[model samples]
Target: MSAGWIYNFPFEININLKAIDDAVRAFSVKYEAFFKVITKSLGGLVNSINFVLNKIPWFVLILLVFIVIWRTSNKISKGIIFSSLLFLVGVAGLWNLMNETLSIIIASVVISLLFGFPIGILISTSNRLNKAVRPILDTMQTMPVFVYLIPALLFFGLGKPPAVIATTIYAIVPIIRLTNHGIRQINAEVVEASLAFGSTKLQSLIKVQIPQALPTIMTGVNQTLMMAMAMVVTTSMIGATGLGMEVLIGVNRIEIGRGLVSGSAVVIMAVILDRATQGLVQRSEVKTDGQ
Candidate 1:
């Protein structure tokens, strides 16, 4: 009976295959055009940014980072922590690679915010859309990071763009989810008071909700940055040149030291970003409380 059922299942399988084939054929042109536009535009934008940023001397960049640390955290201890990571990256001779990695991470994080935050806002405004987007966010968040590489490579063809594409997809989810969560969690009384005070919908959202929710949203951004860093390493498999590539090379050549060094560099980067962003979020919360 089992064998007979298996034989009959081939018809159902064929039907499913045919449906998939038809769908792919129907959307192939649309997908191709979309991919071309995104990959080309994003690739060009990142390359241009890299060109300008790369021209700045490393010393200047280091000084700027330290300045940012001091201004944001307002503490010598935090500045030292930030400086130490930069120093290690320089000493590892992975400075350039780390910069490239940073470039990609920055690009992805910026784009993710540009795109994710709006979707989050939109979802927050509509229960129907929120319901619709929830499952998609679940899938994006839950899917294994490596699984995205296949379709990403298929569409963007293995380079910084593809890696960025993959990284953006993986990293964007946290921001979207958190933004929605934050907006939804805004104090109802505050919202009501704003509405009572002749606040327009936009004004209420901007003044009351967003200001109150900024800390939570920033937390989401922090998570997005961490996830982006992780994806950058995975993306190196597809010709993303960075510390990730170093780790990939080490693995391929069975050089444990190379992998360990690159892996540590990535960890350092993650820690620095996480701490900096967390500090910023904390500062924002404090400011909001003071107000």
Candidate 2:
């Protein structure tokens, strides 16, 4: 009759997640040397990108962006509007911070493509590997983004390296999943016909499978880029410097204006990237269809 008996009829079990954490920590420490090399390499890459971005004259970079937008979209008005939005970030005094954010994103997306595309190809060729990797990708995508920061911090420590590591982990899934999906979605008959016509496995994959899958793969790239951008603010928690850091500072200091402006800059950049990438994807699909 007691409320406890009626409402709390349950058993308690505890999982030793701390033990897993401890194991990871121990492993990280045990292989600290290797990790340091990776950390240093990644830091260098981010710095190189940041330096290049920062060195570009503001007007020149804006013009480049306008050109890209114009070419991809085939719309002069959209190019003008997007370029103006980018210029507004400079007007708001966040251009340098935006560049820093772009540095991190470019580095992360580059690394993601380097690893994800090949793994995706391998997995697509083998059902067993696909089955094995599918659940792992699910875990990665479903796992809280915050959890990625932990391993990243342990492996690479603070600043751009860890930021890149965490962002890459979060963003890479889409490309891998989509690459495999895209390739697998190809017609088996098409692949077989290529083989029958003296196309080597490598040739078929390179020419037929990849070209056909390009649109889907490009979609994955767009998603990966977006996810990397989404991580910018989160990575700021670990000392990443960028528009994200500005937002964090504003939040901590309760400066509504600062946070709002920085957040808006981030949005503007994201919108430009998303639209441009989608336009390219559509163009690729049209080209592929026409072929």
Q: Write the per-residue lDDT of candidate 2 for residues 100-160, one digit (tens) a residue.
A: 9999999999999999999999999999999999999898888898898888888889899
Instruction: Name the Cα RMSD for model 1.
Output: 3.1
Model number with the top lDDT: 2
* TM-score of model 1 vs. true structure: 0.89
The clash count of every prediction, one per candidate, is 0, 0
Residues 1-291 of candidate 1 have per-residue lDDT tens digits of 368766565464235867765675556555898888888987887787677778888888777777778778888777877877788788889988887888889899999999999888889889999999999988988988888887677777768998888889989999998899999998899889999999999999898888888888999999999989878668998899989999999999999999999899999888878877888889878977875
- Per-residue error for 135 in candidate 2, Å, reads 1.2
Every model's TM-score: 0.89, 0.95
Assess the local accuracy of residue 60 in candidate 2 as a C-alpha lDDT between 0 and 100.
95
What does the lDDT read for residue 263 in candidate 2? 99
Positional deviation of residue 39's Cα in model 1 after best superposition, in angstroms: 1.6
